[model samples]
Target chain A: MPIDEALLERMLLRESVSEFLYREADLLDERRYTEWLDMLAEDYQYSVPLRMNVAFGETDAREETRAGREICWFDEGKETMSLRVDQLNTGLHWAEEPVSRISHLVTNIRLDAVELPEVAVSCRFLVYRNRVADETDFLVGRRKDRLRQVGDSWHVVRRELLLDQSVLLAKNLSIFV
Target chain B: MTTVEEPTRTGAPQVRNLVDVKNGEISREIFIDEQIFKNELENLFPRAWLFVGHATQVPEPGDFFSSWMGADPVLLTRDDKGELNVLLNSCRHRGMRVCRYDEGNTLQFTCPYHAWSYSIDGSLVDTPGALHGVPQQKAAYGTNLEREKWGLVRAAQVHNYKGLVFANWDPEAPSFDEYVGDFHWWLDNLADAFDGTEGGTEAFRGVHKWRIRSNWKFVSENFLGDTYHGASTHASVEAVGIGPGGKGKRRHGERQNEGGFSKGRMKTSFRRGHGASDNLAYEIPYPEFEEAELDEYFVAAWEKRKEKLQAEGRLLGGRGPATLFPNMSFAAGFPRTILVAHPISPTETEVWRWYLVDKSAPEKVRDWLRHYYMRYAGPAGMTEQDDMENWDYATEASRGVVARRYPYNYQQGLGQETASDLDGSVHSHHAIAGEVNARAFYRRWAEFVDNLSWPELTELARVDDRATERDAVVTDVAEGVKVLDAVDVVDGPPAQ
Candidate 1:
C-alpha cells in the first residue's frame, strides 16, 4: 500500500535523525567528542544494558525491564559523558594514554514512530579499536536511539545500546562510541 | 643438604610443611610448576574463601552471572525467591555449560545442545525429549532428582563481608572471619572510608576483564611492591608528565623528599598477607578536575580514617592501594577495589576491576569515579596496557629455555628491613624502590602453598603471635568494631 504524505514526512524526519547519529559516530571515531556532544540534548540518557536470556523461546525484548532492573554496561547521563571526554583529553588517563584508534561503522537503520512525537531509530554498529602494539578490539552492537527535533537541529534524547557479547572483550570503554 | 625424596605416583608427596618455608628464598618452581598449580586449585582455592561477584551483580530475582575459582565454572544467580546461589555451570545431563554468558538475568538456563531446562535456582525444570518417550520423565530428570544435589554444586561455603561475596569449596576450612584474620580490618577500613556516610560506597557500574600472561603471583607481587619500576620502565609515562618524575640515581629519593612528586603511600605489611598502598594522585588524573572543588564527604572520610589509624598507635599514613591475601586488592585513595583471580593455567589470570565510589556522593562524583576507573584500570587504561605488555612479555620470556634457567630475581632489598616501634610496623627506607613488600608477599605465599592443614597453618602463623595480635587490633579498629580489651590465646575457640 502506498503511504500517506504525513507518514512519509515522519519517515524522512526519522531517517534524518538516523543520519545525524551516523555523523555523531563519525565524530567519535575521529576523536571529536566535543563535536559529538553537540548532537545530544542537555538531558540526554545514554545506557548500554547488560544483555541476558530471561527464558527459553522468549523474544520481544523490553528495554526498560532488561536495562533498568538488571546490570548495565554503560549507564551515563550528559555530565558523566562529559567527564569521560574530559578525562580522555587530560592525557594522564593512563588507560587512554596510548589511545586506541577507533572506527565506528553504523548501519541497518530502522525508525519507529512513538506516541510522544519522538522518533525511535534503531541501528547496528561495529566499533573497532586498536591500541598501540595490541590486537584490534571489536564491539558490535545495536543502538536504539530516541531523537527529538529541537529548533532547527535534531538531538538525541535517549540511547540504549544492546551488545551481542555478554562478556565485553575490550579492556575498558575508555572511548565513547 | 638432605635430599628430598620423591613419593610414589599414587601417593602425592606429603606436601611441603609450612614451617620449612624459612629455607632461604623460595625457588621459582613453585610459581611455574603445573603440578603445584593443580594442587593449588584442589587445596588452596577450594579451602580458601575465594572472593566471587558482589551481591549487587545478581541483585534482582532471576539475575545470574558466571564466575570461576581457579578453573571451576560457577553460575552465581538469584532465584525466584530472591535468594543468592552459586552453582556449577555444567549441565547435569550431558556435562555442557548450562549458563554460557558471563552475566544475565534469567528465569531458567536451558542447555544449548539438549533441550533440558534448569531454573535460576538451578532446579531441573523440563526435558522435552524425555516426556515424549519415557513414561517416568519426572523420575529420570525431574525435581525428584534431589534438586539440591543435582541442581548445581554450590560452593562449600558462601559468605559476604561488606558486599563482597566469597565462596569456599572446603567445608572444614575456618569461618570467613577466621580466614580473613587481621585482613578483615583492611576491608572494613575500605568500606568505612566510603560507607556509613549519606550514600555509602556505591559500586560503579561496569567491570573490566582482561588477561595478563605472567604468573598471577607476579602481578600480585607488582601490586604488593616493585615500586622500583615506576621510575625506570615507565619513564616514558613520566616524560609525558603523567607519572612520578625526578630521573637520576637518587630519583626515588628525590621524589620521596619532594612531596609534590610522590603522591602515593605504602603501608606496613600485616600478618595473613594484608597490606595497602594509597596514591593521593588522581584516580583518573586528568586536567578536568584540577580546579574542581573536592567533595566534603571524600575529604572527611580520609580525615576519619587517618584519625582512626592514629588512635590505634599507627600513623595516619598515606592513601592505600590495599591488598588482602591470595587475590583481592583495593586502592583506597581512588576508592577502587580490584580482585584478580587466577584461573586454570598459571600463565592465565583474569582481572576484575571495580570502580568503587562513595554512594552518598553526588551523581557527578560517581560519574567522575567511573570515568577515572575506566581511564586508569579498564582494558583501555594506559597503565593497565603497559602492565599487560610487561606481563605478556614476562610470560613469553619465562617459556624460553634460557630464561627459564635464569633465576627471576627478587633480591632488591635483601637485608635492609628496619624495625620500627610504631605498632611494630617494619619500615623500608626506600619504600618505593624496595622489595620488602614483595619479599613479605612471597613469604606468605610459600606459607599458604606449603599445603599445611588449616589448623596447622594457623599454628605456624602464631609463631609471630605478637604481629598477629597487632594485626587483629588494627583490623578491629578498621572494621569499626569494639576493640577487644584482652587477647585470648587459643586456637579454634573450643569449637563453638
Candidate 2:
C-alpha cells in the first residue's frame, strides 16, 4: 500500500493505539518496569531530547536541536534502558529509593503515519511524581512513538519525548514517560 | 590571632573567630546567619569572579541567556557587534525585569511596564515618548531628564577565559586573572582539550539547575576537599554496576582504591580562595562508543598527549574537583562539569551545572559524555540525588540555635600539606584523604569576608610560601583515596 493510504488506515486504528498507550501508562504507574520493558520491541530507541527556552524566531516551539548538534536528557537504546532497570533492581539507586509514587497521565492521542509493521502515534503526557515525604514534580511533555504489532500486543519500537520546561523541574527522571 | 572584623553594622562575628582553619573549626552561624548572608552579597559576591554562561551559549549576535550573579538577575548577551555584556535584568524605570525569558535572541529588550526599550548592548535606544514627548518620563521630568543614566545596569567587567564567561559587579575589584591567581592553570585543564586546540571545549546545550536547602558555602567547600562523606553518601553507586565496587564490565567509576589503579594524589591551593583536590593520574572513567575505531582514536589521542600533559603537570592523574572561591567550581577531569552556586538566601542555594566536552570530538563521543553526565552527575544523575539528600538535611538540622552554636569540624588534614615542587602549590600526600584544600578555602573565604578595603584584600590574598608547611605524615591514603576516587573525578564529584 502507498504510505499515505497506510497512514489513513492507521488513523482508523487510533482507538486501538490509544488503548495501547493507556495500558502502557498503567504499567509504568504500577512500577512494573520489567513488564514495561516487555512492552518494548527488541530494537527500541527511547530518547528524551533536551528542550530550551529560546526566542520564538530562533527555531521551533520546543527550541530543540538535531541529534548530534545538541544533547538529550535521556537517549538510550534497549540495552541502556535495560541497564536502568538493572540499576533499579539493585534496590539501591537512591534516586529511585523510597520508591516514587507516579501517575502517568497520557492524553491527546493523534496518529501521524504508518509503515509496514509500525504505526506512528503522538500524544501529550503529564507524569506526576511524588517521592518520600514532601518532594513532588509534574513533568508534562509531548511524545512521538512508533508502535509495532507483535502478535496481539503493541510493542514500542521508537519514542521521542519533548518536555515543555527547558530546565528540568524534577531532580531526576528515574521513571519512563 | 589576627582577627578580621565583619561589617560593624550587621553585628556579624569576627571572621577570624568565625573560622579557625588551624583548629579545623567553623561556626555554623556562618551558614545560617541572615546578617552574614547580606554581608556576603554586598562584599564577597560583588568582588568575586562569578561564573556566567559560556561564550558559546550566545554564539550568534543578539543571543542571550539569563542567569544570577549571587541573587541579582543578570542577562548574558552577545550584541550585534558580537561583544558580550552582562546586563541587570531589572529596568531602571520601575525595576521590572526587562527580559523575562530564560534565553533568547533579541536586538533590543523592551520593558513590559512602559514600552521603554534598550539595545542588546545595554544602550537606551528608545523611550517610546522621547521623540514625541507624549507620555510618562517627559511629562513628569520635562526635557531635563537624563536618559543615558537610565540605561540597564551592566556588570562592571565581563570576560571569557577559554570560553567560560565570568562577571564581577565591583569595578574596584581585582581583575579576573588577579582574583583567580594561579587557579587559572587548573581551570585551563578543564576548559581546554588535550591538544590545546582553539574552540576545543564547549558546554553542551541546556543547563541543569536545582535548588538545594543549604548554604552555598557547603556546596563549594565540598568541591574543595570534603571527600570524606563519599563512602556512606554514595554507597549505592557501587551496588549498581556503574560504580567500581561491583565485578561487572566496569565501564565507568573505576573504584579509586578497590585495586590501587593509581599512583598518588595531590591537592593544590592558590591565593584568593581558589583550590582543587585531584588524583595524581586520573583518566576519564567511562568512554562508551558505538565504534571501536572511535575508541581507538580517543585512546591514541590520550596516549599521545599524556607525556606533554605530564610535563606541564596538568596530566597529574585522575582528575578531581576544584572551586574558584565563593561560588564557581569545576570537576577537573573527564566529561568536565562546571557549576555555579548562587546564594539565594541564608539557608537556600540555587545551583547551575553544565557539562563540557571536546567540541571537535565526534558526535558519538559528545553524546556518550552527555549521557554519562546526565545519568551519573546531572541534577537527576545517580550521584547527585545522594548529595542533595545530605545537603538538604544538613541545612535543615543546622537551623536550630543549639546546632548553630557548634562548629563543623574541618580538621581532617589540618597542618598536613607540605612544600611541593609544583611552584607555590602545596599537596597532601594522602590525595583524596585530607581536608587540606577545605582549610585553605575557608581561610581565603574569611579573608574575602573581612572588613578590608580592596587594596587590603589584594594584599591579603598573597600566599605565604612558608605558612603551609607541616611536619606530619599523611593519613588515610588507603581509605580516603578509595572513597573519593570511587566517584566522578574527571567531572568533579556530584558534591555540589
Q: Which is the leading candidate under lDDT?
A: 2
User: For model 1, how does the per-residue alpha-carbon lDDT over A108-142 read when each residue is reduced to its tens digit?
Assistant: 88876564446788889898888766546788988
User: Which docking band does candidate 2 fall into?
Assistant: acceptable
The sequence of per-residue lDDT tens digits that candidate 1 reaches over residues B394-442 is 6656665454444455565455443433232343333354455555665
What value does the lDDT take at residue B65 in candidate 2?
88
Put down candidate 2 lDDT per residue, B1-496, tens digits, no spaces.
2223544665655665788876888878788878778878877887788898899888997788899998799999887667788888887778888887777877778877876777774243432112121147767788776776777788988878889999998888788877776667667777777454544788777777766777998889777756566655666654554432222433244444432234345566555666776544445433434467656656665665666676766643434577888788877554478888889898888878888888787776666676667666766566666677677668878889778777888776566665544434566545546677777777777766665688787666555442444443433344445544564352222222
* Steric clash pairs (candidate 2): B280-B316, B280-B317, B281-B317, B281-B318, B282-B317, B282-B318, B331-B492, B333-B490, B334-B490
For all candidates in order, the CA lDDT equals 0.56, 0.70
Task: Give every prediction's interface RMSD.
Answer: 6.1, 2.5
Top-scoring candidate (TM-score): 2
lDDT, residue B239, candidate 1:
34
Error of 2 at B399 (Å): 2.8
